[model samples]
Every structure is written in structure tokens, then in C-alpha cells.
Target: MLGPASVQDLGRVGQYRFGVGTSGAMDDIALRAGNILLGNDENAAGVEIAFAPFKLRFNADAAFALTGADGGAELNGRLLPPWWRACAHAGDILVLKAMSRGARSYLTVAGGIDVPLVLGSRSTQLRGEFGGFHGRALQPGDILPCDRSESPDDAGELGAEPADIALRQRTLASGARRIRVIIAGEYDRYDEAARQLFWHTDWRVTPQSNRYGYRLEGPPVQPIVPIEKRSHGIVPGVIQIPPNGQPIIQLRDAQTSGGYPKFATVVEADLWRIGQAGLGSRLRFEPISHQEALAAQAEVSVYLERLRASVRLQGEL
Candidate 1:
């Protein structure tokens, strides 16, 4: 076992008021797609594998799906393509090698992982250690329970086009991933040079980046004057600029509140892209209006709906 492998669903909601951060799969699109393939709830709990060389043995026959970053998965030595789904018999072993593309992968079963829900979600809260399977990452000898309400025989081999390809969003000409952001309250506080540097330069994701936040490196983006403010409520995707000038985009596991200078917030629709960004990868930010952000979210919704429809048709056939 390698990386922080843990059970996660869509995320914990309606609990931020209590200071609980939403801890969920970084690449929610992958998790949702896997669940959809297995005829499970879109938010069904699945294993989020951040790193590779992961090995698991099926104690019973069950259906499973592999989605997200291509992990080069294999079942009993048979290679499985990314976003592929199939059945596994008792004693069958699934192995995921080092990821060839994205940063995370999801392994979802027919009925999702059977972990107790805390605060209305089954996602692992690593900081709080109160949810998910023991609220921690799976170890070598750990045994996970799966809700096998659906039979393994029901689902044969199936696959879907990866979200990136199927959705087909706009990209940057320079080839760097283009992430859309909405200018936050502190945007104007930065001088012209700092603001221009932020928009023009491609920010490299640093090795220190994690689910809590992505620390970016690029030209320093200093503000016109030193400013201090009270810690305020924050959500995933809020971009903060510290004294170092490098930006840190808060993510799924970010704290409920922060006091850093907010430069911008990556629209929710584009947060998944940041989740899949690999270490040392460069990202270019494109500022969009609030209306455009909503449109982007609608596009995601349409994509998921189309996927659901396709899966339903396959089931009827």
C-alpha cells in the first residue's frame, strides 16, 4: 500500500458552521462516474487512492470500477484501462501501479464501501479522525467492508470515456491547464504589477501541495501595502497570497476559516482540475465573471447527466 488511501463520498455538507471542514475525494468526478457505472448512488463511498503500487484482494465476488488518473490497474494480471468496470471473483487481486497521468484514482464497488456516516457523510476526515473507515488511511492488513446489495454478476465488463475527453472544455494555447477563477474581495488590494503577474504567469504546483491546499510557485505577487484582517469563513477553492507572494489554493480539507489575503477563488466547477494537477504541474488562471462560473457549473451538470443517461441505456440493453 502507498499514498493516503481512504474512503470518501461526495463530501460532508451543512457542517461548516460547526468548524468541520468538508473532507472528500479530491477528484469527485471520478468517484461519481465509478458509482454511476456500478448503478450506485452518485455519492456512494469509494476508496480514493492518491498514490500507486496499491494491492487489494477480494474476499468475495463483487463488481468494481477504476476511475480518475490512469493507475494502470490490473485484476489477476489482466490489464484494466482507466475508467473501466468489471467483476472480480473471490480471491481475485487488484493492483494499481504508479499513475501515468493524474494525481489520484478511485476504486468503487457495486454498493460502495460500508463505513459509518459521521455528520451525514462517509468521507475520511484525516485532521479530525472521526469519520470514514477508522478516520484514517488504509494500512497493509486492513480489511474494508463493502455493501453488496447488488450482485457482482449483474455488471459485466464496462467502461466510459474519461471526463476530460467526454466533457471537452476549453484549454490554454500554451498547453498549461487553464483554471477559471473569480476575483475575490482582495483582488484590488494588490498593485497592478502583482495582479498582472498573477494572471499572466503559469503557476507551478509545488511538492508541498496536498488535499488541504495547493501551494503554487511563480513570480512574487505582493500587495501595495501590508494588510491584516480577521479570520473569516472560507471554502474550498479560495486562493490566498501570503507574504511569500506565492499563492495557495485551499481545497476540500481546508480549514473552516482563514485570515490570509484572498486573491481569487477557483470556481467550483474548475476545482476538480486542481485536484488532479500533479506535482510540478503548471496552471494558468483565467478570470471569469460570476455568470460564466455558473455556466461552467451547468456544463458539468450536463456532462454528468449525459453519463447517467448512457449508463441507464446500457443497463436496459
Candidate 2:
């Protein structure tokens, strides 16, 4: 979602507002990390992919960073660092090719890209047709004007920038409950098999996954139980199981309210990891205690703050 391009949201950081479409990153943490690297606004324009590699050409010299899926990003055949800001010369061709780690990758540029704001948000809301470049994906030849009005000095140095994630990186974790879920809506309607299968089995991501939700392939996740609750608000990470037993894992651009029952939700911290899980990437759920989940969330926050601080200090040099 693109906002007025005024860099206002960067200054107004309190009070989480909810629109027709929810605000926040599908992988909020990773996006923040990218912003820190570029020393740009946290809502800067970057490429978001659903396990598909994105290729773009830079028309000018600028700093950029890729902070999400380890989707191999290369500049003119040379690998670029993930989660570190660097300069891209004029006419540089940046490629975010597919990686097996996660699904989406966010590429932030220095000075941030200027985009129009809609409905008090700057995120892409495909369903509502409000934010982003004309509320749609970037097409070849699309020009994303930059905010020439820049941030103060020390805005772009957030870390020891890198050039790449090592090739052949392995699974994110070995735990079964690493993919935590929270039940929502008609969860009780599904049969025991459906819930057990959903919780215990390994599912493959379909090529059809996109910003809305990841469509998985496995036992159709039916409401193991029958429907009883009314439709309510849903957020990214809530897994909504339809009547056929197929689960739709919500993402950033999901609808405001859904009638479908969500058997679980991926933890906010680990959601980005799941996004990097490319198509055909296998997934297994690992349930964790609420306290443990909270602890992990706290840890991620501290880590992010530390990353920001490190970058801030580096900028001083």
C-alpha cells in the first residue's frame, strides 16, 4: 500500500489503525529490518514476492536492500546482500530470483520511494483497491518516483551491509511447533482427522500463493467441527480452514473480516520465516505455550532494536 509519499507515517508511529484492510507487514519484522538498513522510512518501497523471483532495473544511482526471503538477489550478475543497504548504479539490473527459504522479499531503497497514500495507509490493498502504486503491483516500465526530500545524515547506515546469504542454506528450524497457530471461527466443525491432519501432517505450498494468502496442498482442511461463530476480524497469520478442509494462510493483504474458521495462527515473529518458504516448500506445525510465544516475540523486538541501534551507531562513523 502506497501513501501520500509525504513521509508522514514515518513520523506518526503510534496507535495501530485498522482500515477496511489491515495495516502492517505480512512480515513486519523483516520490512523494519530493511528500513533500518537503508536508513530510509520503514514503509519504503521494496519488492514483495510470493516465492517468485522479481527482476527489476534501476534507472539511476541509489541505495537499496533486500530483507526477506533469501530469494537470490543479484546486481548485474553479482550477488547483493540480503538485509543490508547498498548503492545501485544507474541501469543496474536487480534480480530477486527464487529461493527455497521463504516466500516474500522486501527491497527498500535509500531516501525511500514516493507513493500516494490511500485510506490513511500506504500498503497495497489489492481487494479494496486503495494503496500501493495505483493500488496494484508494479509492472514493467512503471516509474516509482523517489522522495528527493531525504532523511537527515546517518539515515542510511543501519548495519554492516552484506552482499548475500550463503547458497544451500537449510531449514529454519527443527521443531514441530515452530509454526504456532491460534484457532479462529468454525474450528470445531471439522472432524478430528482434519484438525489432526492439519496439525500433524506436512503440507506443500502451491504455486498459486500470493499476497492474500498461501494456498496449501494436502488433506483438504475442512471445518473438523461445524460452524457456530459469526464472521469477525482476521489478521495476517490466521489460518482459515474452509469447508473442503483446505486451509488458507492469511497474509498482509487479507480481507478485514472473514467468516471462515481459522484453526491456528502462525506466530508473528515466525511469520516472515514462513513467507520465505518458497513454493513446494514443506511446512509442519509446532504448537508452543503462549508464554513461550510471548518470550520469542520479546526477543525479536530486542533484536530489532539492537539492529537499529547498531546501524545508528555505525552511521556516526
Each model's lDDT comes to 0.89, 0.62
Question: Candidate 2 at 42: error in angstroms?
Answer: 2.3
Candidate 1, residue 158: how far the Cα is off, in Å? 1.0
Residue-level lDDT of model 2, residues 1-317, one tens digit each, is 11111111221122224546554455666677777777766666555554445677887777776776676778899876556566677898988776534555666777666777666566666665656677666666678776656744334423432212321224446422246655544556667777778777787777767656788788776653456558687777888777666677887666666787777788776776565666666778766667867876787777777777878778777
Q: List the residue pairs that clash in candidate 1.
A: none
Per-residue lDDT of 100 in model 1: 70
Error of 2 at 152 (Å): 7.3
Q: Which stretches of candidate 2 lie above 4 Å from their native place?
A: 1-19, 51-53, 151-177, 185-194, 220-225
Clashes of each: 0, 42
